[model samples]
Target: MSLTFDGTVLVPVADPDDGERTAAALAPYLSPSSTVLVVNVIEKAGGAPDKASVEQREEYAREIFERARGPLAERAGSVETAVLFGTDVVETIFEAAVDRNADAVVFEPREGRRFVELLTGDVARRLVKEARVPVVALPEDDG
Candidate 1:
């Protein structure tokens, strides 16, 4: 079945390049009124880990949003950005979608082998199955 993307689109971005990839994937489906919300979730850990501070993560998120905005500005009505802290990534994304009144949720699958997916449990797969709103997953670009 064919789908049309309008209104607000909630996009959860993990990697820096995910912004560009997601923008490219969703550009075709977007309309003049479409608003893309690029979200970066800092997976919260109980103890201190070898990761950037919250401020640093927020800065990185902004950078990702800036990169995405350049490509999507011409295609979509507007592009927004957010930085969230959560323990459960999927749940956080879904919550954001609901809060933002998103028409759809778009994301890219984590690039890895089947063994890795099996070990970590694919977040994209779980999101597709559990999301209340329409979910769009861009195919992994290995090249």
Candidate 2:
């Protein structure tokens, strides 16, 4: 079967700038009838200090989505936003993709050296390995 982004696409956003870049990267794959769901996950770590409340995280997610919307509007049929609370970010992303019935999950690889990726365990790599649907990893920006 040919690869297609004709259905809903679940895109996980970390911040506004990253969201904008990811949206720009996804432009080529999107069709006029595609719906993009941009999501941000507020990682809940037990006993973590200075963690933002759910409401605060949601607000931040909204801002990121708003910024992303402008660029994605020209590419997709509709763009929506979501904020997810979870301890496991990778799991949350996968769950969201399944729950949304996404045809694909698009995201940029984490910015860091190979050592950093090895230390932190790349989420993008994990997603590609475990996601039930296709995972589209965009290239890192050179600029």
Candidate 3:
């Protein structure tokens, strides 16, 4: 029997593997009722001398989301992307998912753009900690 999934899926993606793996895990389970919502949060205040202010952070997030559309869609079918400002990645994901009435969250277990710098602790875990909705976390194969 097929799982009766309703509403959108919240995918907190930072890289291609996150997108791809989320797609892979979701492929077998997803039905026509499923939709993917990708939330890419680019941290605003870096240790850099020039830290992004509130507006700048939001703008940067928007830009990142815009640039990522084609790539994400290629992996997970149609997706709605959003860039949000704040250090609380957990809160951001929770708010976005709940706001959109997402049935669950499918995500990758990594962060950052490069191989070595990726943060091992994923935002999805935080979602699991904070939100009651189901969160599916996928790790990319080393191969």
Candidate 4:
């Protein structure tokens, strides 16, 4: 069956470059009526000190959104951005999908070494395995 991109889609980006690539990959599937909700999760330390200040992280999230919005706007009816705070990145994305009543969760997996992915509990794997809503991993945009 073909997937429909007529409703709201929740997209999680790891950084500015990820945002740009994801938007490019996802754009082809979206129609002019689709709504893309792009989000960046600020991974909290769960009681310990955070890595970056909240302000800095928020600014970074804005940068990610800005990079993603242009491409998404060309295909989607509207593009919206959110900064999410959570100890578990995948869980935060799932929660956002439920909260937003999203039709699906879309993303382009970030590149990482095998050891690093193993150590960090590979978010892309977890997102697909434990998804609350449908999760679509768009292929990387070579163009």
Candidate 5:
């Protein structure tokens, strides 16, 4: 039997080709009738990035997810979207995964080398070691 899962996808852009590919891969494991929650997390501004900062960033993130939703809905059976903000990215993402009971998390790594890998230190690798659920790291496009 296929397990019901809440998909927590952390995306930077809505309608991004890479994000769509990742979602497509994830779809194979999902039930045709399963539901998914796509979460777009916005980094808190330098300071607190309080209510207003949060709102602005979250709104931007929301737009990205909103844009991605159409493709996600087409690829996956059903989908939902959310905008989240936090000072700590790792903590926020991990918490969201647990809170949503996500079967897996698909995200683009902020690289520290070569390109995307140079900025982020293998977040997907770290998550794989720490996350209770599976984590899929999508390849970053050079273009």
Candidate 6:
């Protein structure tokens, strides 16, 4: 199918390295007129004690955005970042897409072994299966 980047795109990243890699993968599809929304979800423990302070998590999210900003800025008209909080990562990503009025949810799938993916609930699989908006999984950049 043909993918257009004339509208806003929501990209959910796992960490700093993933942010950079995903940015590279997505850059080719974007234009100077496209708006890119980069997000990192900080998983909350539902009502239990949190793994880290909110401040710490927000700071890490900033790092993830920083890693991605340069590459995306080179191609997109604008690059924006958000730190989302939710018990469910996939759900939060979808919610952000809808809330931001994103044209599509685009990402570079994270790498993991089958066992690890199963144990971790396989977020990439769920993202493709559960997204309400169009989702694009771009191939990793060779460089």
lDDT of each structure?
Answer: 0.82, 0.84, 0.62, 0.92, 0.59, 0.92
Clash numbers, per candidate: 0, 0, 0, 0, 11, 0
Output the better candidate (1/2) by TM-score. Answer: 1
What is candidate 6's lDDT per residue for 17-135, written digit by digit as tens? 99999998888889888999999999999999998999999999999999999788778999999999999999999999999999999989877999999998999999999979999
* Runs off by more than 4 Å, candidate 3: 1-4, 46-78, 111-122, 138-143
Across residues 1-143, which tens digit of lDDT does each residue of candidate 1 receive? 65657789998887668787877777777788889899988888757583778888888888888877776888888888888788788888999999889988898776788888777668878899998898988766656
Where in model 2 is the C-alpha error above 4 Å? 1-4, 47-50, 140-143
Q: After superposition, how far is residue 103 of candidate 2 from its true place, in Å?
A: 0.9
Q: What is the C-alpha RMSD of each candidate to the true structure, in Å?
A: 2.3, 2.4, 5.2, 1.3, 4.9, 1.3
Give the winner by lDDT: 2 or 6: 6
Instruction: Give the total clashing residue pairs for model 6.
Output: 0
Query: Between prediction 3 and prediction 6, which has the larger lDDT?
Result: 6
lDDT of 1: 0.82
Kindly provide the TM-score of model 6 when superposed on the true structure, using C-alpha atoms: 0.95
Residue by residue across 1-143, what tens digits does model 4's lDDT show? Answer: 56559999999999999999899889888988899999999999999999899999999999999999888877899899999999999999999999999999998888899999999999999999999999999877676
Q: 80, model 6: CA deviation in Å?
A: 0.6
